[model samples]
Target: MNERQRARRPGGRSARVGAEVHQAVTDLISERGYGNFTVGEVAARAGVADSSIYRRWGSLANLLTDVALTRLNARSPMPDTGSLAGDLRTYAANVAREITGPDGLAVVRLAVALSSMGQQGVQARDDLLAERTRQLQSMLDRARERGEHAPDAFAVLDHIMAPMYIRVLLGIGPLTPEYVDGLVDRLL
Candidate 1:
């Protein structure tokens, strides 16, 4: 296996290290821009030796990418609420909770900054988008099966999620249940 894959093998560093280090990285990135942070600083804050982090993530950029993406995926899977509007409201509420929380807000800020940097940041941005889209798609699939949704499933799903994220990225407002319900109504 390739080195990266080998390092991610079960019981390898990936399996042993819990979310603590990731949380620390998120905090540091939020307080100090990713461009200003160093792995040594992250290691010290996370209470791990620098070598420990280096062995797992290789570089600050890679570490940041993994930290942001991993945390987003760590949220609970979207709920199946039986109706498209109901399911999307639940999904939106869940996302709103996460994105407005301290860790989630920090991760979103870092992601927005990274995304604005163009090609250099495209892969990580794309990976985060794809992962979140997959989660939203699962909810959309359930809605479609229940006959609560119309055609253009992808657009419908995007219409609900994209605005929530845009607000988070722009610091326009907190994602509230009221907002989630509003978006669901418009999308449905």
Candidate 2:
């Protein structure tokens, strides 16, 4: 294989350290709330030196932003299941799984916290929303191209995404298969 054909990974030691730092930030946010933890605490929890985080992420807020973005956006590519219903069902279910994962609540909380954290925080929040919207739009656009009925992305966000996220965030209900399916069915 030629050089350009080789897969380049920034993982190895750097990725491990980054994951550790992200997890440390998530745990600190989960346990002590957003503004309550210091860089030293995170470094200790992540088993890396404080200077490591500072050098990599620059500050607590930057690290927190990275954690929130990485956790919240971690997912497989959106499903292209040949129909709107199939895609919606798959997408909604994936979201349900994510927001209900072990660190789901903490990640959600971190995202919410970041939204109120000032200019940089607001920008991070915007970037996340735009990316999610873009993903949803691609699915919807495919359905439309296939000559099927499809609602605008906002409708999906309002009717489906909002409820599941709210339920998870508020700890009000399980995002069971039935609940997730019902949301998709209602959208269809």
Candidate 3:
């Protein structure tokens, strides 16, 4: 096998290091909140050299963006249950669990905090939102193709997702199954 093939292999040292670094960021954010630590601190927590993070992710904003996006993608996969209503409920429930999971709030906070760190931070936030919108659009498009009545992706964000996120962000309430389903039902 060539060097590129070996590098592309799953569970390689690179992947392990990347995962460790991401976890370190999450832990730090959970413990001390965003902007409370530095890249060096993250490296120490991950047992990696600070230069490695710089080499891989370029900047702290970039690294934070990567962590947020990676966690979001890894957790909330777009659901497809044929009916648009079913898909929205399932997707919202998946998201509810994700945000309420052990590291979910930390990752969510990381994404929120990224918005105020100046140009790079704002750009990262935009990238994260764009990725989410693109994923939702795919599901909505599938519904449209099937001749089902589907609301706009932004509507899903506004009606279903934004409420859940705000509830999680503000510690307003628990995301019960009924609540998630209700959001979907109201949207439908």
Candidate 4:
């Protein structure tokens, strides 16, 4: 193959492997949870070698982290509505749908279970949470620029997101649109 062909080939192969591995990780976690699966299992399921997974992700924890991060990012896009309330409502509704969905719920459970394993696991959990917070902060900054109630980004994120996450995590209440609307109403 020519040089350009080689370069393009690697990109396609790398993307395919990454997608396969990610799907494998999620499927294994969904089937047996995080604590019970092995990297070998993931490799076999993904149709890639174990060494390839290790070379790409370094460890199972890292792989799981990548899976969670990728899935979350793909599912939860930052909202860009014209108003703060509109933005918050859209964001909250998206989050509610994700957390309540099967894939999202599975990832959340796997992430929580993986956190106690070691530093890698803990870092994965922290990283995912940080990314979520960062997205929220960005939305808040946009709202602030639009002359909305501009509280500290972190503080406002905590106030708005904490209860929604808590309700989902604890199974206390449903993350309904009405509930999210009320939260946005109270916040804005």
Please give, for residues 19-137, the per-residue lDDT of candidate 3 as tens digits: 89989988888788897889999999999999878777767898898888786787888988998888898899998898887665765666667876888888877877898899999
- Candidate 2 accuracy as TM-score: 0.73
Model 2 C-alpha lDDT per residue in residues 130-158, reported as the tens digit of each score: 87689889989999999999999999989
lDDT tens digits by residue: candidate 1, 51-76: 87777776566677787767666674
Candidate RMSDs in Å, in order, are 3.6, 4.8, 3.1, 3.9
Model 2 Cα shift for residue 6 (angstroms): 17
> lDDT per prediction?
0.70, 0.79, 0.85, 0.77
With candidate 2 superimposed using the best TM-score fit, by how many Å does residue 186's alpha carbon deviate from the native? Answer: 2.5
Task: Judging by lDDT against the true structure, name the best candidate.
Answer: 3
Q: In candidate 3, which residue pairs get closer than 3 Å at backbone N, Cα or C atoms, i.e. clash?
A: none
TM-score of each: 0.72, 0.73, 0.84, 0.83
Comparing candidate 1 with candidate 3, which one achieves the higher TM-score? 3
Candidate 1 lDDT for residue 146: 73
What is the alpha-carbon lDDT of model 1 when measured against the actual structure?
Answer: 0.70
Model 1 per-residue lDDT at 71: 62
Model 2 ranges with Cα > 4 A deviation: 1-9, 47-59, 73-77, 100-104, 169-176
**Superposing every Cα of model 3 onto the true structure, what RMSD results?**
3.1
